[model samples]
Target: MAITSANQLELLQTAEAVAREKMIDPGLVVEAMEESLARAAKSRYGAEMDIRVSIDRKTGKATFTRVRTVVDEEEIENYQAEMTVEQAKQYLEAPEIGDTFVEEIPPVELGRIAAQSAKQVILQKVREAERDRQYEEFKDKAGTIINGLVKREEYGNVIVDIGRGEAVLRRNEKIGRESYRPNDRIRVFIKDVRRETRGPQIFLSRTAPEFMAELFKMEVPEIYDGIIEIKAVARDPGSRAKIAVISYDNSIDPVGACVGMRGSRVQAVVNELQGEKIDIIPWNEDQPTFLVNALQPAEVTKVVLDDEAGKIEVVVPEEQLSLAIGRRGQNVRLASQLTNLDIDIMTEAEESARRQKEFEARTALFQEALDIDEFFAQLLVSEGFANLEEVAYVEIDELLVIDGVDEGTANELQTRAREYLEAAAKAALDAARALGAEDSLIAFEGLTAQMVEALAKDDVKTLEDFATCADWELAGGWTTVDGQRVKDDGVLEPFGVTLEEAQDMVMTARVVLGWVDPEELVAQSEEEAEEGAEEGASEAEA
Candidate 1:
């Protein structure tokens, strides 16, 4: 089958056959042959040998001529040092000592070496051209999902022939241990395309976290057209996925839009996910509220964050603990990814204990009465009363000077002050339920780590019980609770960062976690610019 004995006749035929099979441009093939013959002459003869090849691809032939010096008589024959007239006429009629003669070499002599060399050059050119075509075709579809047939499988990996070339879908990327046969139809995200030794290689994925997001892109016009945005996504392939969706337009319900009436929109995604569940959670600007919703089917009471530990403590009803954590932490794991937070799910009893201790520390400032209105108290602050304690301690006569203060108001103010006093007692009970302070004051320097450890390690059941920790010693008679150090000494460390820095890190995490929001970031940058401008203007005026 290996034919090495190739001639001018065969070379021409072989070139034509290869051109037809590869469907290469006829002119390009001609250029390839012309260049190859010139190279071959340089390889066989001296570099000075002037070889010219005129290939007529239309006629399927090439004329190769090698020009040589018309030497004097002594050079060709041993008799004399230079050529005579009769000897010179054989090469050229009016030949001088350095004149050149054009001699046509038969193509038959271009055997195994020349033919193999030319074949290699031609194939190389063809491949380069093909890669350019494939690169251009798939470049536009970098973030898109395309359906392709499984061309072949090797070593538990499937190679999908995505029109131009094969894209590999590794075994790990197969959904829920899904299997596929040759020629099976499946959709895959065109994760990447690379110019490889073989050809344009497209890397495909079915289990990538973005697989569902890409499916939504195709199903929802808003996504592709830049209307509704998928902010972040977390997926457990062929099982479930939680996607935090947002919309630029306030009127549009990001979740409802993604989940069409009767679940038609999301159903398309489900099909692509191979029966995996999709939870289109509405994105919230509020982290705590968002975390609560991310862990679905579980009624979360409160969320406590430990930035030092990079952990989130979520408290749900005792009955909802198993559901919140799911079977072997599945629900919490997905929620953690969805919100880009490290979550630790806890029951309400555990959380209540944590909060109760916080209420005890803040004392009379935070109300004890459960019926005390926080909304109204905040409203009072908005009305220019900075201190409820000041209002509570004010005399009735002193209150009369105030705009809204009256006798009835003074009476209500006394009740409000009583509520504040009772809040200390109530907070103790509340803090007792919560073992650690729930979103109250983060443990500061005065607290010792051992004391916090004792509380965390203790079997003190509820926050109500915990809030009553008047003499509830952890191990030794120690009240010293070492706080998680935000920084050490005066130098800033990796963990020693400000809140603004942390927020930026979190925003970056959301991008890597799933879908990105470049526009929102741009708007934020513009707002910052305006504020900076106003500050600069005031400085100039000053």
Candidate 2:
């Protein structure tokens, strides 16, 4: 093959054209071309030689050069990359050991195979530059809504062309009822932009709750103006959705503003979502109030919240129960998602029945544990005494406040409560000792007599056993059995020991038995070192 000025100009022009078509920087394309030329030059100049190629931006002229570094005679290991001091002196007036030398070489004319190789190199570099450009363009657009054309469908995923690049709307992220044909325009949320080995993957989603929120933002001026803010959103794609909004301005009605006149604003979003029903509810700082608003169109009779368990029991009218818990529990499910709470919906009748059962059970417990008659137990239960601990710990003044309980009767009740608890504790301790519970285990600060008995029954009776107990064994946790998570009955369950209390008991046992965990010891040493360093700095400042 032969090369002239026209051939060099054509090569530079091809790089510029490819860069413009790929939407990458022209300078990068030229650099890639130079690298390809240098690679081809290596076949003729010897692979070990340090050959480099440069192309003029304006003239499109190509230049090739070889580079060598001057080194001491003893250090001249490679004749290609290093030149001895004696050889360097021939090329320079006074060459030092560290000086570099460059020699210009005539540009090589590519053969058929080398030209194909250079083309492949240029194509690879162009693809990389295009990927980098796509990443930079879409990385900042994550979590925002983007409009695109449906280019094609592969398997269950839709490929969308978003003007500058293409994105994939995966099967899981598409609305159930939504179907698209080629060239059909659609709006989707940019869920993520990830750079993998293949290229930048732009993941699109139509079913995300944020997609609905973004639609509302486009339709409602109040949300865009910052007067009303969306607090939370829950969506059952193509079926139902719920949004909780709060207004910073006291005068603005967030729900009304979102609904718009004749429901125009919300209807626009509904049409975009393929007729998904949306319920706009006002957000409240009070959790119960928010829950009540979330489960709308159904009147709530009562709400019982267990904060520690992160659950809420909502009692509605018997007739409203089905309404509060919509078809397949959709209403309650969406409400739970919106409020970040576990909601259990029940009828008022059910709640009443449950309360009565609890009252009877508590009354029977008092009758058996305190040796009291049914009448006395009923009186105690009516006075809101759920357990013997309340009777034993309450002030005498509090007992006097209950009807039919004079000071004398209160005193006798308190005495019986204390005596019953003491006897129970003594019985548990004797049983634990009989079952081989170590005295050290019984002496642990957080372990109750009941806990000791439970551990003794489980054969975890020694101090070593207690020290070796895993956190999950002491507190309730899930264990994998038959490829499923099964709940393990913790030793402390019967004693109503919290996870923190169980942890403290285990740590106490470990410390008493002089069992040092290496990980714990390392962490302790690091903390001590940090504290010492801070104290030294403080003393110096003083």
lDDT agreement of model 2 with the native: 0.88
- Show model 2 residue runs off by greater than 4 Å: 1-4, 70-78, 83-99, 404-412, 422-542
Q: Against the unseen true structure, what C-alpha lDDT does each candidate score?
A: 0.66, 0.88
Best candidate, lDDT: 2
In the predicted model 2, the residue pairs found to clash are none
Best by TM-score: 2
State TM-scores per candidate.
0.56, 0.83
Model 1's alpha-carbon lDDT is 0.66
Residue-wise lDDT of candidate 2 within 76-140, one digit each (tens)?
Answer: 88899789888988888899989989999988888999988887888888899999999999999
Q: What range of 10 consecutive residues in model 2 has the weakest lDDT sum?
A: 477-486
Candidate 1 residue lDDT tens string, 155-205: 999988887567888888788778888889988887877877777777888
Could you list the CA RMSD of all candidates, in the order they appear? Answer: 15.8, 6.2
